[model samples]
Target: MFPGPTGVTTLKSWPESAARLIAVAAGRETADLVVRNGQWVNVHSREVIAGTDIAIADGRIAYCGDDASAMIGENTRVIDAEGRYLVPGLCDAHMHVESGMLTVSEFVRAVLPHGTTSMFVDPHEIANVLGLDGVRLMHDEAVDQPINVFVQMPSCAPSAPGLETTGEELGPDDVEAAMGWPNIIGLGEMMNFPGVASGDPKMLGEIAATQNAGKVVGGHYASPDLGSPFHAYVAGGPADDHEGTREEDAVARVRQGMRAMLRLGSAWYDVKSQITAVTEKGLDPSNFILCTDDCHSGTLVNDGHMDRVVRHAIECGCEPLVAIQMATINTARHFGLERELGSITPGRRADIVITSDLATLPIEMVIARGVVAAEDGQVRVERRAFDYPATARDTVRLGRELVSVDFDIHAPEGADTVRVNVIGVVENQAPTKALTKDLPVRNGLVRSDPTQDICQIALVERHRASGSVTNGFVSGFGYKGACAIASTVAHDSHHMIVVGTSKENMAEAANRLAEVGGGVCVFKDGKEIALVELPIAGLMSDEPAELVAAKAARMVEAMGECGCELNNAYMQHSLLALVVIPELRISDLGIVDVRRFELVDLIVGN
Candidate 1:
């Protein structure tokens, strides 16, 4: 059996593996497999060498050069690449598996055909609901696969300390305990920028534990202000950041001795702006990485995974070789796995992608651990479904059925017209703008104005079944009909967020998610139009990725029927409660002013 360079629980067996790898390369031992006649993309040297043959032994690359006939014995399997471009398998340096709305096994099965062989995932979405045990469940399932899946222990549960509440809270002890687990990479994104800048003991303790274990610490400074606050966050021990959306933001991160990760996910198109740091400003490409911070299953199924991100980077004026380095070796070096599985060289894991073109980059074949895993957009390997425990399912507890009155926002006194603070959604971005709108009040209750595309948004506390509903306002959905969308995938906190133009439809949407344990649903005119039931931790579906992607596509169409014109509006709706990002967001506590990092009044001048 070919063993990948992953799931190495102990470091004692490396010496024996290294001996066999050297003997095979020196023609003293027989090789298991050899890939012939290909253009080897040497990410380490930033060059493409033609007519290269790779010898594999014990699932590790033994040689990469002009000829490997010496090691090819009678039993060796020869794979003729037909002179294709042999690119190293792509890696997503940062992401959330829960954002795909599928389990780890399903996520791997979806991206394997897309040439994604490694992923560094953060389970913070599940951590917000089930705590460390939830993270362990994901980690265990990640290692059982044939590819490399590194788990980053969630550093933030609520994300923000007091501005919002969650189903569970993770502390320094949780971080310290996860450090010793197999496949544990490092700490997840530290979203508590305020806590880090203020020298909060709890936040510092988690960073200290990760550094003591000699692991990487992810950063999330959502603020665009590169002032003293940004410098303070760097001093807090985070080694990289993916929150940057500008060229200057990337420059600042690299200048501060941290890697700047450019992300092109389902909704966030941030690569065009940040990649200019290398294309125009001539910054070193080694300090930059590529990732997909959050991608829905619809994007993964319709579009490619890391292949899509790499193509976008190449289109953004980056050289194909340079962009390949950003996705391969640059990511591996960031996580201290440079010699393990990044490049197609001796001693690295035998993960290869045979592509027909460098610019278009169509993946024709994928080989992981010297075995063919996928070919021509089809997964050929066997993937077993993980049987998630019953405790992980049925997590949506609304306590009681919500009614129209529960979503109504009462005005101050007997006011007829009221000015309220609203969360302004930015197209293809994570940060929201704090905008105020003046609207008519009927029966002393503030209502949504569909003519102006202003809709009412609410956050329902489902963790403890408190039946607490906090209502606010949001703009820019362009929703005109009597429709509502609800989801249990609110980022960082995982609360149920309901956004709609009608109170009755909003109530209907919330009840729909509660009925199916948890998931996303769209309701129009007091009836559910589409839904995707995610029974595991109220975050991921136990079904196949293609099945979840189908339901998500219908949900997107439902948003279109209701007058939403934004691309992937469900992704934007799910992020309305993410309090870690600026400038405004709603939470279980109340409407939070993220810039101020405090709970503020929803009604202005009250």
Candidate 2:
């Protein structure tokens, strides 16, 4: 194999290797590899043609037709497909690698067996903690992979400018500098949708830099109101969006010339509700793409990746060919990479998946860059772990040990009972509901009402070592005992978020993460039940995916034991501090009313 900088297969430019490819296709040169007697799932034409053969030279498809036997030489390696379907390798249109609690290399290793050969990753989660350097780290590691892993320069590090603060900040200059990187696909999801709609110069400058570099701009318009703000956001130059949770949201995005990404992550089940725009309304399927926005390691190892999304789409009333098209060609076309690696077409990278069924979509074998990367649900290649710098670790700086008294919320003067705003979690979705509940006060302090399912939530500042803790109330996880969970992997802004019914348990959870540098920990009745150590930027671990997934499974079980019964409750817990999505969230600043885009008082006085 022709190795690149880090032992990855080096793909020569089409111009540099065009003559060899042409000669191989014309039977004038020997082919390096040949796959014969397979049914090709043609995404471009939406047809499955039988008796197909493909010829490869220098890690790219040189010829694909009914027969390529003429190009095969005595030394050429051949694989008999045995009447299997030769489908293009699947692509994840948008995702975050850090969400898996594994590094880029580990994440790739975990999903390669699932037939995902192409991924458009947004490393904004790390950017929120380590800034541009962190993005560069992930970008460098991504290019060293056997498959295609494109990085999008993070557009919003803090996510919301004035609403929250992070360990690092990325601006327009950073975006411009990153455009010159070899693997940068475009600007990451513009999480600051309000900033884009209001013509914020910083948001526009980043968008302009991406456009000026001739790259696609990703979007995250996380609002249900598709009114003036949504239109303004579209006008600001985001080529695609993956935050649509409704059918109208998908229709609006496609109608406005933006690709709509239907996602089925570990927690977010959005494909069934939004795919109707194409399957039912008769809209073009080319504008709809499938993605896993944020899947944990447990989901990647125990379940599947893009293959799972494709199967789910097929089960959601979409045709098998149409779902495959949505996952492959549609995503490639959106990112302007259709000519490079989307289908079983000549002159493209030789990334194909051999499967026996279309609807079930079992990934029997996966070939990436003309090499057998995985077969029979096992990776066949070696992937080395990328060593992160020491500066990237030990990021959980809580300044001082947190105590139970620090979490106490003093009641106003002498109020016996007061109504307060609560963040209501919506299962299987990103958006939360703004809710209110009345609670009794004892001894001049407000207490969480376990009977009403209301618990205390805190966002502890970990970046500046400020020792600042902002407290709020959230109702959704039906926890019964004195259970608390703490995580440094909070979205957009990687602060420490602790949610629990008991102040003492919450303190213990938060202090444990700070002691371990960073990670997610569950504490019940003053005992640590589960912990997943993520020493890299306090967001990811370099350990093997199986080990991490095992720990994550235990964490999930612990949540269930604590009386929390939400599907993927850990995901919902991690996103509580995401101030971009409505309608309520907590941050280092204070409790944010996302609907109004301002900080609001916690108490409702009569």
Candidate 3:
């Protein structure tokens, strides 16, 4: 990657006559390091120029031009550039580190090789479990890294008030405590969009603390309506948003002076839809930041990080230079790091990536703070392995063994056929529908219609397990073959969600997962098929990312074997309980009508 960058930068600036003369005169002087020649893709100038020599000292680029011979010393390592394009290391504007199911150090190793130097991370998933302590643990790990990893204190614990109950709730006090941490950049995504718009005191207090600290506040306005509520949220001081799934959403955020972060993660292909705001509508790309809100370990190891976003933007008709600007300098500017690491400039961190092709972005080498961290798809420094506390494991408590009677949905007496509301799952999307279906009530028990693919979905309360199980019907999995899937990795609230065609299989799936402390398990004909043990707060596995990815892949294959063929099945499974993102979801209490923001009954049309 270093040689590629040297080649690309040198090719672009070869026309300067005085630079070559100076280089020839002062061949080998004293300097910390020297990359003999390279081509530089300058995001600020929006130009690709070659014949550039980068001089570095004290982890900062002292000079970047064709004539850096005067800066080179006998001890300085001279790396010959074999004509590769040198660009600034990529920056992820918004992301959730835990979403990848990797600890901070593991996530760093996975992405560092891909040339991602800086990240603005939100750990709301863990915060929902362990509150401020969890946030502190993440913050402590971030400050010790070799590269810049900024933490954003999570503002919403349950995500939506009155809709769900998380294990721990973070209020304004917790927000203020995290604000002073060394690595904390600001508040995380304000997932409580309604709270911010409605002037909820607790939400406002957290936002005020972030603003008073002089850090940028994050936003999450997921609703389609861009009306007064949206206006009120802008007034609440969230400086950036990543939930803009449309061009109108992007325009609205930018018009209100918030950076619109377009994402193209493994599960979310939002960039193609919203990049038109800049490429077609001619909106300024400066306020638009590119990010990957959630990426699994597989995508990180196989596909590139910010390079993927830049490629997607270019494919959506954005100019190559414009796309680079969005991923680099534009992102740095949003985080108030414009003068630091976003560009290939003097006094900036000598973090850069060398790629063979800008369009393909085949990353050959990755450098961070003037040291090679990864080369040719390999990590240079050993990544740290964190130990999950004993208390973190074995957190799944079922209270008592579940019985078939627990899944029974009581309806009005003597009703031959009952019309019920079902949480209709949508594949590859966050939203669910309040679907209704009339079913035959036999033996005083509501049975699932396998022909209609309306499988039984249940939320077995894991936190403070009062043995409270909320059962409902959900379609769209296309499950068959007496298989059941259970997971403690439910989003926001982190309850155990079980979906199955057979109650017996469901019980086995749920119990087997509990036996392993906490994890995702699939059962077929009362026998376990696959399980990914997440013993840490019942959220993340302590295993290496590659091992975890393999387990997750097996889980996906198990879902496929069970007659379900949805894209990124585990993602859909994890997000089933995310009340903030959609029309309908299930919680420990009962089914939630997200549109109305109220607790809804499992039995409808009673």
Candidate 4:
């Protein structure tokens, strides 16, 4: 059996064992494992060939041909595929492990059973809280996983420089230093599109460092406009983009020499809309890849991971072979790892998924590095725990106990009503709408109108314990009654974001997270209704995925009880403070007009 965490680094390089692999392929030596009589779903050729036999040695494919009978010996372990489809292990081209609400080890354990053998994770969420130390922690843990877990150096710590503030800032120096790490793949999604287009030194320096290291530069151009700004951003060294929402967005990215990553995350339903670029428009499918940008623990444990994305793509009219290619070889090629993995061809890592069906893609068995990792929807390997240091926990510091008055928004003196800018939540999407509302003032304080589907949103600074609260208005949660939800998982800045219909409930929810180190909690009528403790830098929990999923499911139920009917509304709540996406977002600094890339007053014309 393979030794647990150290097995990853101890795996011999292909060169060190090439002679043995050659001998096995030449039928002069027996293979360590031989899988016979399978229908190879050849992703490279977009074809399925039956009666294929694959021989593995030294954790890499030695030979895949019509027969490996000559390489069989008495000691060789042989598994009869029985005509099962031997598909390449699915790879999530882009994702955030922290968003899963589980530590790296737990996230890997949860997804491995779903046939996700490789993950390209961007730890920007944790970077917002613990800076370089946070990113290093995840990187170290990721390298120890049994499967491929590549870490992308975070490109935007604050996401937007002046629009918000983070616990730490990562500049070009940090990016360059991280590029030398063992598993560092590239710079993460460049959320600062405006900075890149305008030739901002810090953003350009990071891109240059990744390019200099011959690594891929990921992109996040979260704008609908495919005009000059988009073109400028593409030229700024980002080789791929996963923020495209429309068919035109996908088309434009591919046309500009950038790979278009179509995502089907828990809350993001973007695949159906953008997949037409290939199905209808007849663009070459090679430039298109599938990914899940963000998925919570419940989604990973219950629904699926990359397998879910591939099935959804097939449902969107993509052929099974093409969808499988998008999820496998296309992702590997995008990251310049075609020779390492992504296919069942010789010399690649022996990462294969066996399934009886192509369309449904039920993962009957998963083999990673020539070892059985998962089978029958269960992980077969031992679960390894990566202990996070004490410094990574108990990060939530509210400076002082918050009260209902701390959430009050003082109105202009003697004003009965005021027009305010509200952050409008768009269901199943990342961008919010900038909305203006005429809200009444009571006792010289601006009030939330629950009847109008409007509620108060506050960004409480947790990193520095500044006791600073930036309050604003938001709509579209459909929340009723005296309810509030607070999470320290706010994007980019990782501040505590509280959305509530009542000031007292908002205060209670905020204080609840503070009291428990850090996590997400919901409050109704001054009582805690649900909670999920994410004590690791306040972005992820150290617990198992199922336990966290149970808490998350209860939290979702609580949201529904409070009258929020939006699908995956909790995801929407967490992103309310992401200053990089469109329209409006609240931050530690103030209400951010993301379109304008500047801070705007909460009250209009004040």
lDDT of 1 by residue, 1-606 (tens): 333324432221235579888898899998888999999999988888999999987777889999999999999999998889999999999999999999998999899998999899999999999999899999998977867899999999889988888888999999999999988999999999999999999999999999999999999999988999999999999999999999999999999999999999999999999999999999999999999999999999889899999999999999999998989999999999988888999888888999989998898999887777899999887765578899899789999999999998999888999999999999899999999999889998997787777999999999888999999999999987788989999987898999989899989899889999999999988888999999898999999899999999999999999898898788888999899999999999999999989898898998
Cα lDDT tens digits, model 4, 97-163, are: 9999999999999999999999999999989888999999999999788889999999998799888
The TM-score measured for candidate 1 stands at: 0.98
Q: Which stretches of candidate 1 lie over 4 Å from their true place?
A: 1-13
What's the distance in Å from true for residue 158, model 3?
1.5
Whole-model Cα lDDT of every candidate shown, in order: 0.91, 0.92, 0.81, 0.92
Stretches > 4 Å off in candidate 2: 1-10
- For residues 1-606, write the lDDT of model 2, one tens digit per residue: 334323755566678778999999998998889999999999999999999999988888999898898998998999999999999999999999999999998999999999999999999999999999999999999978888899999999889989999999999999999999999999999999999999999999999999999999999999998999999999999989999999999999999999999999999999999989888999999899999999999999999999999999999999999999998999899999988988999889889999999999999999988888899989887866688999999799988999998898888997998889999999999999999999889999888898889999999999888999998899999998888999999997999999999899999999999998899999988899999999999999989999999999999999898899999999999999899999999999998988889988888763
Local distance difference test, candidate 3: 0.81
**Of models 2 and 3, which has the larger lDDT?**
2
TM-score of each: 0.98, 0.98, 0.93, 0.98
Q: What is the lDDT of candidate 2?
A: 0.92
- Tell me how far the alpha carbon of residue 7 in candidate 2 is from the true structure, in angstroms, after superposition: 2.0
